[model samples]
Target: MAEEHEDPGVSLVTVDGIEGKLARVELPDGTLEDWRLASLPQGVKEGDVIRIDVRGGDVDVDHQETDRRHALGQRTLDGLNAQTPEGDLDL
Candidate 1:
């Protein structure tokens, strides 16, 4: 019989990109891996940093980082929108 063990350490990661239903994340150690977005918490988006509890495989958002990234993204979108004409904006 094989013995099962749980990991005791948590991993900090950031959302790098999304391909279809998979979310590519960058680990604290700088390794990249893909996980199912459906398996992660709600409202996760690119550039959002999160903490993963290894034992339970639970993910929690780093609110501060998430907010910062959200603001940055909004600013970027605003800039793009400004460059775009009123009727030419795509959604």
Candidate 2:
């Protein structure tokens, strides 16, 4: 399980996906949680990393974290792609 944020009431959650009015999120402990799509920040979509200030009752997108994670994922994908041979494969 992942440890909670240093601050008692602050933590991070990832928006795994959205369906209609609800969104499925992954908690810090890797458990699934459902939240209202309207309750989240405007323009939020799948794969967005959000910062929740539970004590302050504030929920907002953590843009830096999201971008960082995206970049890391892209690098991983690029590395994997580089490992493949550069020729067409026989059926």
Candidate 3:
């Protein structure tokens, strides 16, 4: 049998301050993680959940963008040379 448990991730973060569009969150591990909450109230303070998300790949913006671009580029080239959901495409 396998035990069920939440993966080690960010939680119970105390919000320090919101400078512009950034929310500085202090994690349960005593480290800080920055979050971006667009159009939401910055009222989260000193002790709050703030937000919850996958901490690893989701936080690597540059690497994520590069990966996405590479995937799309590969799909485009593949589609142009083969049959795809978009129908036969021209290169």
Candidate 4:
């Protein structure tokens, strides 16, 4: 029986960070992969969502998806911080 999993031909990853020529990406499985900056889209920055075509080795920035994910993250943060409060304590 084939195990259930996402499509292997395509993947969506977020730009985690960039180090020199290497770009760090967070995969859907929460694993990190290092890709050459040259392989990514021009002007790629942290938090940018990328769509990778594994078979064709094509990578592109998904602006719409990025915005969606960003909004989702902001909503999550806002929801989590809405209730429980804590005062800032300077150390």
Q: Tell me, by lDDT, which candidate is best.
A: 2
lDDT per residue for candidate 3 within 1-91, as digits (tens), equals 0111255663234455577777776555677767774523344433333334456523222233334545776887886767666666665
Q: Of the candidates numbered 1 and 3, which has the greater TM-score value? A: 1
1-91: candidate 4 lDDT, tens digit per residue? 0111277788888899999999998877888889899989999999998888889988899898888878987777677666556733222
For all candidates, the clash counts are 0, 0, 0, 0
Per-residue lDDT, model 1, residue 61, is: 81
TM-score of each: 0.57, 0.83, 0.35, 0.75
RMSD of 1: 9.6
**Residue 85 displacement in candidate 3 (angstroms):** 77
Candidate 1 lDDT by residue in tens digits, 30-90: 7788999997778888887787777787788878866776788788778888898773356
Where model 1 places Cα greater than 4 Å from the true spot, the runs are 1-8, 67-91
Best-performing candidate as measured by TM-score: 2
- Using lDDT as the yardstick, the better of models 1 and 3 is 1
- Extract clashing residue pairs from model 2: none
Q: Please give the CA lDDT of all the candidate structures.
A: 0.74, 0.83, 0.49, 0.80
lDDT of 4 at 37: 92
How many steric overlaps does candidate 4 have?
0
